[model samples]
Target: MDIKIYVCHHKEGPFFENEFFKPIQVGRAIAKKQLGGMIGDDTGENISEKNDNWCELTAIYWIWKNTNHDFVGINHYRRYLNFAENSQNSTISLDKNIDFLLYCSQNIVNICRSYDIITSPLCKIHQISSPNNRQTAYENYSFNHFESDMKLVFSIIKEKHPEYYEASQISSGLDICFFGNMMLMRRDIFNKYCNFVFSVLFTLENIIDTSKYDYYQRRVYGFIAERLSNIFVLKQQLLGGDKKAYHAGQISLPTFTRTYDFSELNTKLGFVNHPAQTAIEILHGGTVHLVISFDDAYMLHAIACIMSILDRASVRDALTFHVIHDESLGSPNISIIKRIFINAKIHFYDVRNDRFPGLLPRNRPHISKNTYYRLIMQDYLPREVSRIIYSDLDTIFLDDIIQLWNISMDNAILAGCLDEGGLTQSRKLFGKTHNKNYINAGVLLFDIQAAKAKYGNLRFLYAESLAKHVRNITLQDQDLLNISFVDDIIHLPLRWNVGSRIYGNNELDYAYSEADEKIAAENPAVIHFTGENKPWHADSTHPLKSIYLHYQERASQALQHAQR
Candidate 1:
């Protein structure tokens, strides 16, 4: 009726010595009473003997696929079975099974601790007869290095945990096949079939192969058993015994990115250079979707600014907002803006500490790096919409702003603004990085259907391969768009995006200030505050602050009026 299950967390070898054992101890403590409580013992060690009360054995050890001696697997079989067959209590129920978490990444970790990674998890126990740690890099780093490289999953995880870098994904079989084993798994693949080859053979043999139960064998079985036990525990949990799944580590929920379907939680993230062709299709068709992303803290702020400008119409019905905070410093402020939106009817998605962007290599996650570049070329646009306006959240709207929707018919892809107007010398100081002729990625209107009809996935997706192949990649996104449509692009007026440097000057400031005062009378298409200056804070000196504040006041007023 009431039970508690704790999964094992075994850390192995010198690097992680007994790291996993501590949790097991705790599990045993918590799970010691009656037919319940697995304080720390992993259930894979469970062996059911005919019983009157409940369980024959307290735990079960999962026998992984990599038993070198082959004898250890037998020992595992016999120990569980003998315990199951000969237990004193006939009143106990065999109906209960313990859980273990073995297989995949868990398998890899077990192998690493026992001796070598590849052999322990993959190499069949037969061919080598005797396998020692083949993972020794110093003995043969040159010839053996290739094998170590195959551990792509572990490397990425390590990098992801501590804000390190991913080992980089290659296009070979690994790219298309691997879906991250990110979530914790409870039940292993064992339940699909009832027969265990080793389990059957040992029962008939009268004698257990005692020699097979060494340290290596123990380690190997430890991991395999761990996985199976995890699964069993999960089943029990869902079936209604106790809490079986605890995040092996603290986990954060992912931020809501823009998604095409509204019926379910949006899982994928969309990143493009401005609003490509697909964005237009959705808007024109009058379909609704949400795009969620967080590449930079500024980008998050930018989205807030854009929506603030859009808020004048008090139009919260058309869109929902989702954001994941990647950094700690800006989180409080971003949250304040979200609370304001919630009061006005904008849907505020739950943002928690579990998921992150800082963990990603380019500060971009969701899609692989190469795939993002391809988004620029063609056909890479999401098809639901032929095109949509993609504007960096930085810019503000001085006018009604819906006119851009009117421009959606045939995308000339009106785009402009670059490098904070050369105010930040860093882009150029990086030499080749600066060479790409900055086209601020801050604004873009995409024609999705056109791109699909034309080029295919572009130079953008293959930026790296192109960089290695073309020898020029300093501008990254800027370079790809430049080569793709610099000549073809129909330039939007400078008024849409006024650069920071020129706008910063005192003389020009007075002239634009007065001009803006008059322009405020009529709507300007969109006013982009293209740099560090923003209207959200008291310090933001953007010429359009007067306009942004106009909407903020209106949003508040609209909310009060609606309450009445």
Candidate 2:
């Protein structure tokens, strides 16, 4: 559809033919791409009704969007940019970079999607070519086209919003621009010319209103269209005031390692990730002491979770696992578990120690007189083993837990789950002995080596429960465990011990780790189900469930083989 969008008259020609008029040229060039409206600015002195033109490019955009690529709303206001040399003047800033033009197109694509879908320049649900028949649910997670757009976005952001220069450096996941917004991509496809398309729309709409910039400009966000990195664009006028924004783009964000494949996890029944030894590598470089104890028949699942955590870690060395089971339950195939840990260049040991704090409260006298112990304490672990990782069976791994395993043990005695506070007041009656802000024993990282060095013999092996009556604790293993380490443990990051109970429910800390309205530009390294959302269980909500389902596919094939 041909539409005449009149701009402030150009000296060389009317808006359409004026290449030297930046805003007009940017607008018309974008219009040809069929994305959206162009920015309008004119600088000339004759001062007639029409001659004044949309000069100075000063007025800010309020709200704008249409069904698809077309903009149905009319321009709201026109005024001169404050810096305009004269009220009636014409100035232009244009670049000949084709990549910059396509970078604009990327922004346009995202902006068009933000508006009503029916009016977008590109068709919805078109076949986005991928390497395979099935496509990733999250398509906008990488960038072969990043370097090109990075140059453009960084350059423009440097010119307009210098405060964000530091943040842009840490923008690790902003690869494809928008999260799950597009389809598959290749390295060379990024250079294509969709640039000026998005900029014109951004110029006429709200762009990014960053922390560093707002402090200086005394401006509110307006005329924003999502950039490829999903950051909104701003006019040159909106910038220039912030000191923190100064040369900020000069400081970049952490670069992405390998992209996480959430798409693989979203659709599957059960999938298996490659065997990674990330946990082992992180703890003491390859040595970790671990203990696993589950009551009443849940060993296979626990074994699976531990192996999965180990496999995902780059370091799978110097770790030990003690299985404290009263009876022999069905076992998982050794070959399968071995295959899972094929590359693990680590040592594994199994122990059958069953001593726990409830029965023999000798080493630690902190257990509540009313608390019944379901889990064995650190004393139950082998004498040689120090700093053990305790894991529950239901939990699974999304990334290397070793990064968690390797946490510095400077001053902490024990490590466990941070009390979620739902049942906060339960332990207050016990005073200092029972304690507040106690730990959850579901996952524990301890320093047995340090304990051994501190105490002459094993001081923990001789502690006893303080009560004449056993308190009926709400969480079986968690309560006593917490009371034991209330003053001793180090709180692990939420990413490492993330549980299913808080998946959609609890308030997020560092808050970004929880489910968010903003789509992740990239996938998480690991997602754990410490509570109920086990991959095999019916109530799973992990975005990467499909990834585990693929493993189920392999398991199914293996089951069929065994039957044959």
Candidate 3:
């Protein structure tokens, strides 16, 4: 069987290609450069100019009209359908080892022979959102997108393709969905699908006024097509006849990260490229880097936290620990740290405490001046360290830190779990004008390079912002961060950073559904001891304190053996 899987690209970057897997530039009619050795969607009956609104559909359309292959499929430059035996068909993975993740022409042909259509696996809506609301596809779509456009689509589907109207309605009310407009099927089936999807989308294009939509919302057709593809498949399955319309196989879409090599910067020009970054000693592939800051008081807590992470790490997992502190962490403590983490890669950064003098929050003893150390990470971390996971010393790890590291930053400066009390705190500090959902600064994934580019010197930016709202800054750096990078932060699931405050608090400033809190509490990756009740303290009452004590005892035992 002849198969051609067109990998779509908008700009030149790292891409995988083969005889069966070819590269094609989408929206070439409006693009500036013609990437070499690749076909363009602009040729032969195309809507390349509408690529902004249509997205990858421009490439799908180009294949339908231009190609005559037996089996046709489409994939993005970074994302691909994983048919590899090692994939196990359950989890999404990054293509760190290209050979293992990808399949050759003969391999793909052999696999697809058993299936009629291959696409992404089905996703449950409840898992992604609050189960209390029990959001349906239509309700979910309306919440995120323009409701009027979806309503218009319903009318059009009912009038034009009445055969699929019931399937569409059924899909809209169900919690399951097949996302990402990607699939491989027979030529005839492909054409029929293209006909059905494009007919509804082109009609939608004619009726809706996308001129007023924002840059992101303008890609309305692509969003709707994701759902329509689900409906199209459901309609085929529901067909009541002796012959089944189509047999579909759903595969997991594994997104590959663009790997970087900073080993070359180990030469004399180490400080040349990234001026804000510190010296690069040793950075390598498949390593998860974590950065933390604390003073002498929290040294034990930091040790316990680090032990928790190293305790759960797999043998294959390589972890690099970066500790940021001032002269307060004496030479003896540093020596103890070196011995405890002897098997692991670790680095120590010393910054003067006097750097942040009067900027410290008043009447807040629990919040130390060392809390501001995270702000200067862009100026402290190595150039090779583009991304780093930052955590407060008052927390312990329960699951793999690699899971937190692998999350796509999506070009955001930082990603963390939302703080339910953040909005009310921000309103008190910076007035009601600051309304964006606030994230707890306890556990954070920082795209350090992007942060450096966004704010030249983050410490300077914090100091500058602090001068204006000095009196109002009660929560110290947390308040400052929420105000500074308010629009630039992404809110991840609560499971990643489960705070103890969420266990009993009811008057939340921002609403995180009870169902979400319950899920996070049950299976947490990082348990943060927020508020004054710390596990180490005598009066503390946190229920998860026993887990912390378990790690603390082990950490102490490790420290004692290291002293010998």
Single out the weakest 10-residue window by summed lDDT for candidate 3: 241-250
List residue ranges in candidate 2 displaced over 4 A. Answer: 1-285, 294-300, 317-320, 330-382, 422-436, 452-469, 507-526, 530-535, 539-564
| Model 1 regions lying over 4 Å from their true place | 1-283, 287-292, 295-303, 312-382, 408-439, 459-476, 506-523, 533-564
lDDT of each: 0.32, 0.36, 0.73
The TM-score of predicted model 2 comes to 0.40
Give Cα distance to truth, residue 265, candidate 3, Å. 5.8
What is candidate 3's lDDT per residue for 188-225, written digit by digit as tens?
Answer: 77898899999999999898887777655788999899
Better of 2 and 3 by TM-score: 3
Q: What is the C-alpha lDDT profile of model 1 across 119-233, one tens digit per residue?
A: 0111111101112213221122112122222243224324432221121221121111111111222223222111331232223222333244332222222222222232233
* Better model by TM-score: candidate 1 vs candidate 2: 2
lDDT of 1: 0.32
lDDT score, candidate 3: 0.73
Q: For every candidate structure, what is the RMSD over all alpha carbons to the true structure, in angstroms?
A: 24.2, 20.9, 16.8
Per-model TM-score versus the true fold: 0.33, 0.40, 0.51
TM-score of 1: 0.33
